[model samples]
Target chain A: QQQVKQSPQSLIVQKGGISIINCAYENTAFDYFPWYQQFPGKGPALLIAIRPDVSEKKEGRFTISFNKSAKQFSLHIMDSQPGDSATYFCAASHRSNDYKLSFGAGTTVTVRA
Target chain B: GAGVSQSPSNKVTEKGKDVELRCDPISGHTALYWYRQSLGQGLEFLIYFQGNSAPDKSGLPSDRFSAERTGGSVSTLTIQRTQQEDSAVYLCASTLWGGEAFFGQGTRLTVV
Candidate 1:
């Protein structure tokens, strides 16, 4: 079963605009949510993460908005740039148990300059 | 010395052949993981190794797939009698305790 689901298989955003990607999960036990960015020929790197206790977390230009009741979370990139073009994945996991991550299918983002 | 490292960036093999992929986790990291990425697909969990704890093989797709971590540092994934559907990019990641994971470049395996 796909525990986590994401939308918009691909996204195109203009430079300096906002880029958004959304994800939802079915497992209520998941308490940690993280977003990863991956460029071609490279592994996915952690961009930002949020816990269920917080409503939102921001790091530099990247923000993660999480809704605990709804079991959903999203990543928003402010002032998008061409260098931000890459594939993004959302993942969820529980801390008490094994740290195996359940990932969304992924979204390919293109920031056009 | 600083990040997770994987060997054999690319491998092409005939069907029914066995293939082995290696991963070297960062120094002092206690958690290691393996994931698979198919074309246009998300990272699929394969296995995980924590300090001394039993490895979690629940995510493994089939019995033909197996993994082993030696000395709590390096890991090896072995695939027996590979099939075309097994072709994908294999990624390795390492983390300290329960912190964020660091990923390696990955190894692209193609089975004909």
Candidate 2:
């Protein structure tokens, strides 16, 4: 069973526009949601994360909007740029443990300049 | 400080052979994790080690896949009797307090 599901296998957005990626989880035990950005031939890097207590968390131009009741979370990138073109992965884990992340199938995003 | 480092960045082996992939986590980090990524697939958890305690091996795909951490610093993942289906990019990550994980460049394994 896929504990987390992500939408839009691929997305194309114009530069300076908003880019959104959504993820849903079936495990209520999950409390930490994190998004990772991966470029070709490199490892995934942590982008932004949110906890269940917060409905929204923003850092610079990146934001994570979470809905506990809906068991869903989304990543919003403001002023998307061509440099933002990469694969994004959404993952979730519990806080009590060592935070073993369960990942979703990645979404490839292309920000056209 | 340097981030996580994985050795043998790329390995190509014939079927039925054995291969060992190594990871050096960040200094002073107590948590280490291993994950595998296949083409067009999500990251699949393989194992985790915390300090000197017992590791979480539930995610290991089979007995052919095993890992060991020595001195709570470095780890090695061994794959025995490798098969074509075993080809994938193996990733290693480390965290200070299990919050945000820093990943290595990953080792690409190709089995023919």
Candidate 3:
């Protein structure tokens, strides 16, 4: 069963625009949420992460907005650039469970120059 | 090494054959993980190894899939009687107990 769910399997945006991806989960045990960026034929890399303790976390132009009670989280890319075109995955895990990660289906983002 | 290294970045195998994929984790990393990604699909957890404790094999699809970590550093994922459905990219990752996970490039396996 898929523990985490993501929307917009694919999206296209003009450069300098905002790109957003949303994810939700039903497992309350999950406390750590992270986003990953992957290029073609390459493994996914960590982009940003957030804990339920915080409502939002931002790194550079990337931001993660989390809602603990709603069990929802979203990634927002500000001024999306062509280089940001890639697959993004949202994952959840809890520290007590040996950090066993549960991932959502990926979203492929395309930024047109 | 600076990061996790996986051997034989690509592998082509015949159905019914057995294949082994290797992963070298960064030194001192106590947590290791194996995940599989099919074309245009999400990653599927395979297995996990942490320190000297027993590995978690609950994610393995079947008995045909098994993995072993030697000296808690290098891990080998073996698939027996490869099937066409077994073809996928096998990715490895290593991390500290509570730190970020660093992933390898992954081994793309094609079972013909």
Please, what are the lDDT tens digits per residue for candidate 3 over residues B1-112?
A: 9999998999999999999999999999999999999988888899999999999998999999999999989999999999999999999999998788899999999999
Error of 3 at B55 (Å): 0.6
Clashes of 2: 0
User: For candidate 2, lDDT tens digit of each residue in A1-113?
Assistant: 78999988999999999999999999999989999999999999999999899999999989999999999999999999999999999999996657999999999999998
What TM-score would each prediction reach against the true structure?
0.98, 0.98, 0.99
TM-score of model number 1: 0.98
- Give the poorly placed runs of model 1, Cα more than 4 Å off: none
lDDT of each candidate versus the true structure: 0.94, 0.95, 0.95
lDDT of 3 by residue, A14-101 (tens): 9999999999999999978989999997888999999898999999999999998889999999999999999999999888878878
Q: After superposing candidate 3 on the true structure, give the runs of residues whose Cα lies further than 4 Å from its correct spot.
A: none
Distance from true location, Cα of B30 in model 3, Å:
0.3
Between prediction 1 and prediction 3, the one with superior DockQ is 1
- Give fnat for candidates 1, 2 and onward, in order: 0.90, 0.88, 0.63
lDDT for B51 (candidate 3): 96
Clash count per candidate: 0, 0, 0
Predicted candidate 2 versus true structure: per-residue lDDT over B1-112, tens digit per residue: 4999999999999999999999999999999999999999999999999998999999999999999999999999999999999999999999976568999999999999
DockQ of 2: 0.88
